[model samples]
Target: MQFIDTHAHLDVEEFAEDLPEVIIRAKEAGVAKIFLPAVDLPSVSTVLQVCRDYPNYTFPMIGLQPEEVKGDYQEVLKKMKKILDASFAQSSPFIAIGEVGLDFYWSREFEQEQLIVFEEMVKWAVEYQLPLMIHCRKAQNELLHILKKYKHDLVGGVFHCFTGNQNEAAEYLKFDNFVLGIGGVLTFKSSHLREDLPACVPLERIVLETDSPYMAPTPHRGKRNESAFVANVLRQLAASYQVSEEIVASITNQNVARIFGISV
Candidate 1:
């Protein structure tokens, strides 16, 4: 039942006091690795620090989240570029360019800015030959439109925390090297993923994630989430696909490896 949490925020304050315990519980629950996605400039350091502490057990990604884009985004990215270059030069590069994409969930005030930032991220991913960990919401059409240009150049990546319909799923899958990131949303009683997903998304093109410190599954619905809960996501996905949990874990782990070039 080994697993990989392809997306999570273990560096956040919620896990500050007991991150070690959280990692222990995740390992106990068979989560062999966790990928940490940076949301903003500060998180870059935090995510790196956590990955440094855990070494091979956890990996770090670099990118600016769309939701966090602001007036100073250009300056922030400039500073981050220096850090990214330094890491690359040192031979300790981040696993992916991630937590980056279009998110019009809250407001469209930064719509243009998000587009600019996302294009730059796409460029970064292509230039670095690293995969992307996209976080798209309410702007899939636009995101896909932009992504179409770079489809051939992208190495591979995951559509992190995917909760879209079948049509949207199909569109994202058009990118040969991309995979949909399945998470707690699939387990919600109200979610159509149980019915909708299996038909469109192939098990081999899917990966498990908790998106933790958020989106905990059914039994832990309203509570804080962690990598350990990816087991719950794995359970629901198995039932949805009518396969054994071991099958789900194996395929998803392979998907993670293919996309991010990591192993348990």
Candidate 2:
């Protein structure tokens, strides 16, 4: 039962000392690939280094995370685009433009800034013909509005760390080019995803993730998450669908491969 950890931050400082063991554990646990999403300009290099160290097992995506979008976002965006352009020009392009979107959970001080940067990133996705890896917090409505505006320009993407309701999930599915990225949130006792996901989303429209060094599954909750724990998400998703874990893994692996243009 091979799988992909669709949205993990292996380059985060939390894993600095033990990233090797983390990848070993993930490989041992049947994780065929770990998708690394850049959270800011510096992360572009960090993710690149991690992927370089594990060329066959790790892939990188470039973008500034919403929380990091500040008054200097224009500069940040330029730096990211420069890296992406150089990579493409050198025949070494990233697989996606991601870990990008809007997040108002903390503050709306940068709302407009985030929106502009998001639109730019969306254009980057289309320009590169790469899928997007989106992150959203309390700004789903605003984010959805922006997505609708550029629906024709999108190449599809995953709504990573999804925390939406049935109706919200339904709205995202309308894009036809998107998928819900299910992660440790699904294993939380209080998560709405437990009910909404199985009831509202078809298994094929889902992909597995761990959001590593962040939302580790239960028993490992509040602890550092790593790629291997995506198996926990796979287990619960199977329960939600009343199927075996292997079936869940197979379906999700296909979804990841199809969406990100990678094979396990």
Candidate 3:
């Protein structure tokens, strides 16, 4: 059974010393593809290089993470868009605009800035016909509010690291095209995700992700997350839905392909 880490920071420095080993281990664990979403301008080149090195096994997306939003965001977004255009002209375009959205968990210091940048990035998705890999923390209401304006324009995307309740999950499901990205949090003993997720979302509207170098599943909790460990999250989801791991992998892989338009 093959799996896809719909979202992972595979190009970050955390894997710098032994990225090849990580890729090998991921393949051994049945992870067929890993999507690298950029957090800032610096990450553009890093994600590009890693994706170029691995070719189809790894892919890239450019966007300014909400938490990373601050002064000079305009300049950063401009440069990122330029790189995206040039890269697309030279080769296949990026799959999405993501790992981007609103985060109010830490502080509201940059809330306005985050909203502006988030909307701009969403516009890029609409303009380029790319999907979005969204991240939200304590701000789903705001995120959904903005997306409502693009009811007809936005193609689709994954609501990465979704930790919301049934009602919230229902709201996203109403979008018809978007899916909830489930990851390591579901494996946490204290998390209500496992129980809540199974009953809240249908298998068709869900996808798998590691959000690697972070959100490592149980057993590897509190450690650096890697793509291979995504299998743990897959196992957790399978158990939650009372289905086999292979079944979970197959459906999520199909869902990932539908969202990104890339078959695995």
Q: Which candidate gets the maximum TM-score versus the true structure?
A: 1
lDDT of 1 by residue, 1-264 (tens): 699999999999999999999999999999999999999999999999999899999999999999999989999999988999999999965999999999999899989999999999999999999999999989998998889999999999999998989999999999987999999999999999999889988998999999999999999999999999999999999999999999998998888888888977
- Candidate 3 stretches with Cα past 4 Å from truth are none
Q: List the residue pairs that clash in candidate 3.
A: none
Error of 1 at 251 (Å): 0.5
RMSD of 3: 1.1
Tell me the lDDT of candidate 3: 0.90
Top-lDDT structure, candidate number? 1
Ranking by TM-score: 1, 2, 3
Off by over 4 Å in 1: none
Please give the lDDT score at residue 143 for candidate 3.
91
Task: Give per-model TM-scores.
Answer: 0.99, 0.98, 0.97
**Candidate 1: which pairs clash?**
none
Task: Summarize candidate 2's per-residue lDDT along 1-264 as a digit string, tens digits.
Answer: 798999899998999999999999999999999999999999999999999999978999999999999999999998888889899999864888899999999899999999999989988988888999999999888888888877887788999988889998998899866999999989999998888888989999999999888888997998889999998999999998899999998888889878888989
What is the model-wide C-alpha lDDT for candidate 1? Answer: 0.93
> Model 3 misses residue 63 by how many Å?
0.5
Clashing pairs in 2: none
lDDT of 1 at 161: 90
